[model samples]
Target: MQGPAVSGEEEPRPLLRTMLGDVLRRNRREQRRTLEDVARAAKVSMPYLSEVERGRKEASSEVLAAVCDALRVELSDVLAEVGRDLAADRVRRERVIRLDVALGRRTARPARRSGDTYCLAA
Candidate 1:
C-alpha cells in the first residue's frame, strides 16, 4: 500500500505495522514457536494474532505487550529495532535519490503527470 501523500504525490512509505509484524514473526521463528503457542500464551485468539503478524491489524498497546510477554521479549526492544530499521531505510532512499539527481537520471522536481502533480521523496 502507498504511504501518506507527499507534495500531492503518492509515494510508498514503509508501514509500521508491516515492520513490527516482521520483527515479531522473526522472533517467533527464532524461538521455534508456532502461532498457536504464542496466541495461547498471549491470551489472544490465533486468528487475531496471525492478523497482527501479517500486518493486517494494528494491535493495541495492551495486546502488543501481551504478545511480547508471550514471546519472552521486551516491547521496548522491539520498538528500538523498528526505529533502527526505519532510519536505515530513510537513509538508503535518500542516498538513491541523491545519486539519481547527480547522475542526471532524474531531478528533484520531475515532470508533472497529467494530474499536474509531481512526485519527490519526502
Candidate 2:
C-alpha cells in the first residue's frame, strides 16, 4: 500500500472550504444580504449556512454551487479569487525566503511548538 507523502509537495496547504466561505460571505455582505436572505435563496437552513460561512462546516459541491447561485456569483469567480490570494501569499513567502537566504539561514520553516513555547532549533 502507498504511504502518505511527506515531501515533494511544493505549495502550502490550502483550506478549500474556508476560502470558499470567505468569498461567499464577502459577496453576500457586499450585496447587503443576510444569512436569512441567502440561505432562503439557496434553499438551505439559516444555521447551516451560517456554519458554512464560518468554515465550521464542509459543504458539498452542490451546496456550494447553490450558495454561489444565490449570491449571483460564478463559482469560477470564487475559485479565481482564492487562487489570487494563494498567489499573493506565495509571493510573500518567496520574499521571506530571499531575506532568510541573505541572512544565512538554510530554511525558514516556523519553529515547532514544544508545550508552553516554540523550540528554536537553529
Candidate 3:
C-alpha cells in the first residue's frame, strides 16, 4: 500500500488558532492559573482545554466565549481578534478568486443579458 503523497506546497499555517492559543496561554500565565484550573472554571474538560491551548483544536465561538468569561476577560476582545482574522482570510480568498477569474480557471456569471447578448451556462 502506498502512503499519502506529499505536495510540494507548504501546509497553510493556522494563524487564528495560533493567536488564540497564545492569548489563552498568556492570560492564564498572567493570572497564575493552571490548565486544570481554567478548565474547571470554564466548564471544559482538561484534555480539551489543553488541545485548545496547543492550537490542536478549533473551538466554536460559544466555547471560546465561555473560556474567555472564565478567564475574567471580555468576549469582545476575543471576538475582535477573531473578526480581524476572518476579515484577513476573506481578503486572501477574494484575491485568489480574482486571480482565478483572470486566468479563466473560474468564470463570472452575467447579471443581466443585453438586447442581443446571451449568458453562457457555467
Instruction: Return the top candidate by lDDT.
Output: 1
Task: Give the per-residue lDDT digits (tens) of candidate 3, residues 1-122.
Answer: 22222343434545677668767877888899999998999999999988888888998888888789889998787667656766675544332223344455756664765676633222
Error of 3 at 76 (Å): 1.6
User: Which 10 consecutive residues of model 3 have the lowest summed lDDT?
Assistant: 1-10
As a whole number from 0 to 100, the lDDT of residue 114 in candidate 1 is 84
Tens digit of per-residue lDDT, candidate 2, span 78-107:
889978877766654442123454466687
What's the TM for model 3? 0.54
Q: Name the candidate, 1 or 2, with the larger lDDT value.
A: 1
For every model shown, what is its TM-score relative to the native structure? 0.69, 0.65, 0.54
Q: Work out candidate 1's RMSD over C-alphas.
A: 8.3
Off by over 4 Å in 1: 1-11, 95-122
Report the Cα lDDT for residue 92, model 2. Answer: 49
The Cα local distance difference test for each model comes to: 0.83, 0.77, 0.72
